[model samples]
Target: MRVVGNYRNPGPQDEYSQGQGGYPPVSQPAPVRTEVNAGRLWAGGVAAAVVAALIGLVGVLVARAVFQLSPKSSSAFGDDATVQLCVVAALAALMATGIAHLLLVSTPSPLSYFGWIVGLLTVAAVVVPFLGSGSLVVRLSEAVIHLVIGIAIGGLVSNAAGSASRLTLGENR
Candidate 1:
């Protein structure tokens, strides 16, 4: 059988021989087969935007609640403080989430649905208790809310900042 690319004891005049110059004709060097679809770009970008928006919403609620409960004695959250804190927290969360998506995930997949679920559940953790917590329920409910919010916030931040480093360093881990 004649084998393609076989170079066993090639003749003197054959390519790769001492007489003939090395390297293939420069006309082409194997055209690269690339799959660049606009759909993929749009899907990834929108998914990223949605995650950012959700992070914003969840962060606003959680931050507002936490700040409200801070030891500072204020009858009502000053307009400037409440608005500024929520905005900062939301923007931080959104940017963190987008950065996370870019770093952590290779090839955008359905895995980000997991983020959506976690973000939503984190919001629920806070909202449910505030609406009705008359007994020891307030403490338990707030604890759950804080834990979930912390997890969501921390995960987003870490995923964004440390994804590449973690992947390269933690290969065996």
Candidate 2:
């Protein structure tokens, strides 16, 4: 109905002139996205721990099978094999956890990273006492070592959750 150029839309010229909103206004740039929630971090850490534990169990089964094919005697099971398997399993678990920390974490806060490293190492410490088959007291000491290491790892993991926090200790508020 009016004199116009050969075009259906105003094209790049309109875009250039009126800006995106069809008017010139002092534009506020978009805000940067920071780390949001701790849930993922905590869950991921726990998952790492659980997966490591499962692998350890698998090592136990493998050890039992390799050593005790046909049980001739109740105590015929080689303690050395059991100890090796547990130690190997602990190492494997911690190694996998370090990998998890490197891979799974989206936001790498220093505390989070430190906790991850230490927590994984604690799993390794859990197996130190099983280096050689020994007396019952020594074995019990090994377990005590494992327990202390586990508790320490748990504490370190708690620190991991402190980073990337969107929630508080107990409640969402």
| Number of the top TM-score candidate | 2
Clashing pairs in 1: 100-160
Residues 1-173 of candidate 1 have per-residue lDDT tens digits of 22345324445566555655454433333432223333443344444444444554454455447654433554344344445534544554555455445534443332365466446655664565466645554456454544454455646544433322222222221
**Which parts of model 1 have CA positions greater than 4 angstroms off?**
1-9, 12-29, 67-173
Could you give the C-alpha RMSD of every candidate to the true structure, in order shown? 11.7, 12.7
Estimate the TM-score of every prediction.
0.30, 0.32
RMSD of 1: 11.7
| Native RMSD of candidate 2 (Å) | 12.7
Give the winner by lDDT.
2
Error of 2 at 76 (Å): 15
Measured with C-alpha atoms, the lDDT of residue 29 in candidate 1 is 36
